[model samples]
Target: MPRVTFPHVAESYRSFKMLMEDLGNEVILPPRPSKHTLDLGVRYAPEFACFPVKILLGTYLETCPKGVELIVTSGGVGPCRAGHYAQLHKKILHSLGYPVDIVVFEPPRLYPLDFLHNIQRLNPRRMSYRAIYECIRRAWRKLQALDNVEKLTHKVRPRETIRGATTRTYRRVLEWIDRAYSLVEIEEAERSALEELQKVPQDPNRDVLRVGIVGEVYVLLEPASNLEIEEALGNLGVEVERSLFLTGWTRDNTWAETTEGLTVKEAAMPYLPELLGGHGRDSIGNTVLYAKRGFDGVIQLAPFTCIPEIVARTILPRVSEEHNIPVLTFFLDEQTGKAGMTTRLEAFVDLMRRKKAARRPA
Candidate 1:
């Protein structure tokens, strides 16, 4: 058994922990978002790598130094740099003198061929079928619970006292959920957490705007990576409805890709016949989903050099044309600053506020 470091603590952490523990390996949760982690990534990774890749690389370096034997992560391939990160990380770690084995779960390209192979590789110890099934069930539960928390947190934050308090509690609940023996227990825990969250008092006058944020997964999750985009939106008197939280991504979207590809024909049929790479299909799906859900607007955040999103950029215009949804795409990099992002966010919020205001009956 190898000591593992699960990077990116958004929503999938618990699921990964359950699966790894089922295989009888010790797992250490990665440190929370911090400058220390970001600095490690910025200093070690290539200049053009996506923020998430850099952060994961930095995490690997730190965890490997602490004696972790294997670093398991999902890798995507296609016309995108995301697919190349695992190999790049492997070389980077080797060059830096870390002996960590990089086990990458290949993302589905044409179908789920690579995905199944990766799953087989992950369970090399040949654990019993029942045990494996249990692990997967636990993982799925963890994802659903975490995603529910994320969705509800965003919906309730503008109406709560402490910002992101629900998110913090959800993390603790995740660790506990992995250990729960039954689904009923998990449901009870969620109920209790939501009840506690509702107790937090908030100002009724606060403007709550349901703005949809779409883009790269890292930018959506890592506050530092995206200059605390969600908080900025919250402060701007708008309720931020993020589109790329990991729990929904891993459980709904990623899991679907593992099989014959889950089709969201009901939601985004007009955007079908187009699958760019990385999250191109998801972007289109989420765009339509957000629009139909009555979000004020959408913000697509991706690294400056992201290819899949660039391709998505073209498709989204057509989506906007069809749905009359306003989408603002931001390309981020090392040069992106908080002040700049805030200014743009403010403008976007102002536009959304005026648009919504016009629709209300006087």
Candidate 2:
């Protein structure tokens, strides 16, 4: 099978890769987020599509040869637009003249048994409980560690150098994290990445503006969609913080599910029932958490039609007002541009700088 994988946030890739390898199929990794990717995605995708979805669809077009047999990816189900992504992508790909199997890995929540059965079909070499257990453990640990390191880097001195180093190191580790078959190797990789990142010398004179990014997972993590938000911030001498990174999500939320009785106070359950679905519950908790962290400001990046973020959007103003933090909400669709986003981010950074200066002890 001429298989390919869409790039996602760093931490999720390990578990994704381990599962794929277990299934006895190799996936061609599309290049990481760069100008090249953004251009390709923008050139080929439909006008009204979500940014990340466009990039993913474009990635398949760019990578797959004319005779390729199949493309596979995880898809969601429900009122959320995510559930329809696979079908939309498939239709779009077919219209673009690539009529092949768009094998979707549907959400297990809606079809647990069917999900398992599909996995079994894909990789008949059933994973032993011990093996599955080990992989999950490693993936979680590395993710949490990476999250902690990133958060600390943002608050530290010489923000750009530290942020850049840590990011590069984490990316390197992520690409290789799946190859580890033991806990020790995972631990070693985590330690080595952090140590290398920390060794990047800090500059004393650079004034770093710290800004927080929040919102739907796709727009936040996928660079093709966000126009390299982090890099744009860093270029403007600001340290960018994102609430949707996999490590932070895994640490603040997923840990409770996997480690029974080991709850983290940072992410409390929202009073509102999860109304938007998918990651709705987490967004509620995260909105409150980001407010408490005293970040300069928060930027929410949801797809134009993303319902969960719309719901979160209603709640976030209350969180921001109560905490007195400025919040910028961006609804991104296919038309979002690098220049437009850059201008907005530059303005936000200037606002943060003025706010910080106002409080300086003179």
RMSD of each: 4.7, 5.0
| Cα lDDT computed for each candidate against the true fold | 0.71, 0.63
Displacement of the residue 264 alpha carbon in candidate 1, Å: 5.3
What would you estimate as the lDDT of candidate 1? 0.71
Report residue 232 deviation for candidate 2 (angstroms): 3.0
| Model 1 TM-score, 2 decimals | 0.82
Q: Distance from true position, residue 11, model 1, in Å?
A: 3.9
* Residue range 251-307, candidate 1, lDDT tens digits: 364324323343443345566565566676667777777776677888898887787
lDDT of 2 by residue, 54-156 (tens): 6676667665653545566777644677777778877777877777566677756888887766655445356765765565576577566556655545544
Poorest lDDT segment (10 consecutive residues) of candidate 2: 257-266
Clashing pairs in 1: 76-83, 209-239
